[model samples]
Target: MRFVLAIVAFVVAVVLVGLGIAQRTVFHESAKNNLTVELDQANPFVVVGPDALTAHPGTQTVSVSGSADVYVAYGRTADMNAWLGDVPRTLVSYNKDKDRLTTAGTAGVYATRSPSPAPQRKDGSATDAPSTAAPTASVAPAATSAPGTSVANVPSPVGSDLWLNELTGQQLVTTTLSLTSGISLLISGNGGSVMPSKLTLSWPVDSRTPLAGPFILGGIIMFVAGLVLLLVGFLHFRRSRGPRRGRPRGLRGLLHVPPRPAKDVTSTGEARSGRRRRVAVSVSALLLLSGCSPDYWPSPASTEPAIETPDATAPVADPAASAAPKPGDLQVEPAVTVPQMERIMQRVSEFAATVDSSRDAKAAEQRFTGPALANRVANYTIRGTLTSQPAPPPIPASPLTLTLPQQVTDWPRAVLTIAKDSAAPTVAPMALVLVQDSPRTNYRIEYTMSLAPDAQVPEVAPASIGAAPISPEFKGLVLPTGQVGAAYADILTSGDASKWYNSFHTGGDQLVQQLGVEGQNTVRSGLPKTASIEFTTRVTANPILALATNNAGALVALALQQEETVTPNDGGTTGFQTGAVAAALSGFTGKSSKGVQRVTSIQLLFYVPSVSTTSAKVRLLGWSESLIGASELK
Candidate 1:
């Protein structure tokens, strides 16, 4: 029984030692995980929507692998082009107050004018008064050693890093990404997109290296000691049996004593050796088991990696910088020192000047957003197709706005109605509306309207404090804000045909003469008398906005289309080369050269107003309309 137990212990120890080696080798191997994300862009920014990943615990080497392609947004291709032409320089200061950069012991370089060097006087004495001269920023700085002067020899703020803006996408991209702590592996800069882009992310996972060399070594030692115990224990049991002796079999035999009791000894004393063999083997087996100590086993790994101290003999980490931008950096809201309107105008000027509006008008994007951007693009394209020399409307000499400060609210907003008399009758002033949604976002042009002479504008809060955007549902106005757009739409749809026709005044704003039935009949009146004319005008289905007025009235903006089609009883076609209609319908050839001319007039400039007073008719404040599309159906 003892022999069997000893052999079993030795086998178990050997298996345990093998297991230790395998655990040390396999446990240290790294692991990998794959991640994929779809990204959306809001211009100059890309946001990742999927949840962030958590790497496994322990030291691990992580690597990210993937490919992505990004495209310029609708109007943004021009901004990129401008960047290629004359890239804007970055301006950075040590702090938010640009004026606070202390330099070279001088108060600053902002003196109105440099004092002319004191004139040399007789007797080698200088004049007390400074010489007069025109102001020049380029003047060389005075020597600090001069009387009443104290200055340091440092570079000016302009010469320092304060005036440089880095235009690279790399820093922005890397700074935008983040990872969980204590994860091992190579990670590269991973961030930013061109908008509506697809991205793939991959990294190694499941890597753990908690156990140390000592731990593995300890485990092996334990197994070896167990084996030794088993071998000795079995040998002693066999010796006690008093079997034949004299060099037992192989290694096992070497451990064996004579297989005879002490009283029955051979002349060579082999019998006595067997008698003591049981005690000797038992002692040896005990010592072997004790030899397997915890010191040989590996220790548990530390939590986070510590910055290692420099050592004379240890290999050091590479000095290369982690080029990624620091994750989660916060930026203060930028303040606009210039009026928001001016800021918008500057952007507009820059865009109109630099952008290739005919080919790729991306510069206009900064000054426009939403519908405004769309309209500009469409208009540019149409003008190019219709006229031999299409010129974008010149920016007016001065800004035409009601309030100096503009409206203020959660989203600061401004409405600019710019107009000028032109030799060209079809030309009208444009109403540009700018909106700033957040502190960080620049004010973008949201909506625009063209105005006619009779159009009236409602009173609004000053720019010092902007008006709050009212809900269409608000009932403060005699007409609910929401119903204002619909009401205007209704009037256009029915004209005299509407049951509420009495609610509108045709003669008051001359709207009736133009939009009423008479106006429709007059246009086709010029068409062949034999041709039947049909006029269909209705408010566009697009959203009508009612901005709240200080007087409880609503500044309503509405858009609609007016179409007049003429069909001739005689087989005569309306020629394209004719009257004022030709210029108006330039964009549309309608059934080209056919007698049936389908003139589709699309007028979009929807701003109008409704008063808060009860029983008051909707007011025709001024409005501007454009021939957005003129098509001739074949």
Candidate 2:
């Protein structure tokens, strides 16, 4: 019976071990789920919707091929569609029930138009020349193109500031992301007429077998038990078969018989050695199995049932969901997302660096506009003559401290951002105002001002929930946005005597202290006795940008032109100092019969508190000054 039990145990152990090993090797499922789609219809741009990316519950790996240069970008779905505009594109979505990706073609006509001309300076010189080539439309080709039809020309989406992230590769591109709803991917072929022809998406899947380890461990235990049982059975048999001394025939017989057998020393020694070997083998097997990972073993399932109280009956409402506009309601998206703004700032920083190094006014104009462009172009011109002139403060790319985008869904969008340079800690942070005139055009920096050390930025809507653009005539503030520049100009001219002087806070205002009436009087005191000086300050023609803050006030940005003229009082003429900025800009080598005039462009950013606020004042946040123009008095 013992032998039979031992044999059965050994058989059971072998079967269990074999089954466990087989489960892990032959019965394991694929570690990842992969799906490949081949395009039957060619399109200029292919958009992969969020549904396809989030179909599985893990990070998605997307791969594209069949193009010389593959380009991929992901951003907000609304932004992608807005960029597409009237242009058509192929939309790819996932059908969970069908377990496959489906593509639909949007039908639309492709049209090209000339880009708007760049703004001109006061001297009628074009700040930047517009591209003569017609802008290529990024539209989708017909679902089934007619025979002999050439591919449609498609503009590449590379380097667009709208994208939160972008990737590109030669012939193939692969990226992994864990996407959420309302986010999408755009794929193209690096400005080629045709997009990539193939796409592969993969997601990881769990393939571990919980029972493998338990079964193997159990088998090892049973094998050890079987070996012990077999050893015991064998010993019993040996004892039974051995010549035994008959206790009855007695004591004398026992001693004589045992001695005659010679004790079978070799068999006894062999048995003892075999027992030790079996014990060692069992211990080795246990140690080997013990080192395996817990993932191989079966996990204990919870025995407690889920219990719900009255409080748990209702699901918690998501704040974002609650705040979202209801169906059929107008939903206005921000001009740009936070990540998109960051990318734009980085590009702007790079462009600024390039322009600064080369002193290229034309190149600077491409990324700058209005007062910002004027200042940069003037600086470049001054540097051309006066190489020692300091360049404008650098626009850092990283550590975007604040972002305020306009809440609108139309052309001519604006966003304000404050960025600091980690590499240059001593340099003050810069506040930039960027504008996008149309879907086809990239954002350009309109105003760049270095923030004051003690400047305080008011609370505003989050980047996700952008603030509304206030009109010039908005009365919610202590003063109208349109009049802010003129008011500040008055304060600069009349000092405490100006009626509007008290409306602003001049403490810590560097511009005010440097260009105010007191400062101008000081300049007059230094001039030649025969020379007379006059100062005139007025708002420029540049449009003012005002974005609403959370406190019902508005953050305003405007430009003022300050003219300083020095004329000889007694029919004599005066000239600028030898190395003055005015001399360099005017190109006047020596004293001129006519007086010299210098025009300084000042860009100011202010925060005006609402009328309801107590003891409110217009606070200066940032400012920039540049000698934009200088000439001999006409």
Name the candidate that leads on TM-score: 2
User: 1-634 in candidate 1: lDDT tens per residue?
Assistant: 5456546655665665555556546545644444344332222222121122222232222122222422111111111121112211111111124322111111222212212112122121332432222111222222222212221321111110101111123222221122332111111112222222333334444344333334444544555556567668778767878646664457774574767865555544875577568757765674565345442344564355522211111111111111221345321111121233343464454455454344344656645554555555555655555555354455432345442222221122334434343434465666655544322234455555556567666665454333334444444445554454445545655667866566554455455566556666676576666666666665444334344455555565544555555555666555344433333445544333334333232333333233446566656555434444444435
TM-score of each: 0.40, 0.81
> In lDDT terms, how accurate is model 1?
0.39
Candidate 1 Cα misplacement greater than 4 A, ranges: 1-338, 349-393, 403-430, 435-447, 450-458, 489-497, 567-575, 578-615
lDDT of 2 by residue, 1-634 (tens): 7788899889988988888888788988888898788753355678888898778866778899987878888887766776665545778889899899988877434333222222223222223443323122232221333322344434446666677788889889987776667778888777665568888888878766888887887778778788878989998998889556545555664564435344687788889899898889867877587437765776764222212101101111222121333466445657777767777888888889999889887777668888899888888888888989999888899899998887654556788888999899898898888877655567888888899999989998788777766655556679877678888999999998999988999877778889998789989899989998899999876666777788788888878899998888767878888887878887886776778899998988899899999999999999988899988877
lDDT of each: 0.39, 0.75
Worst 10 residues of 2 by lDDT: 308-317
* Most lDDT-accurate candidate: 2
Say what the RMSD of model 2 is: 7.5
lDDT of 2 at 545: 70
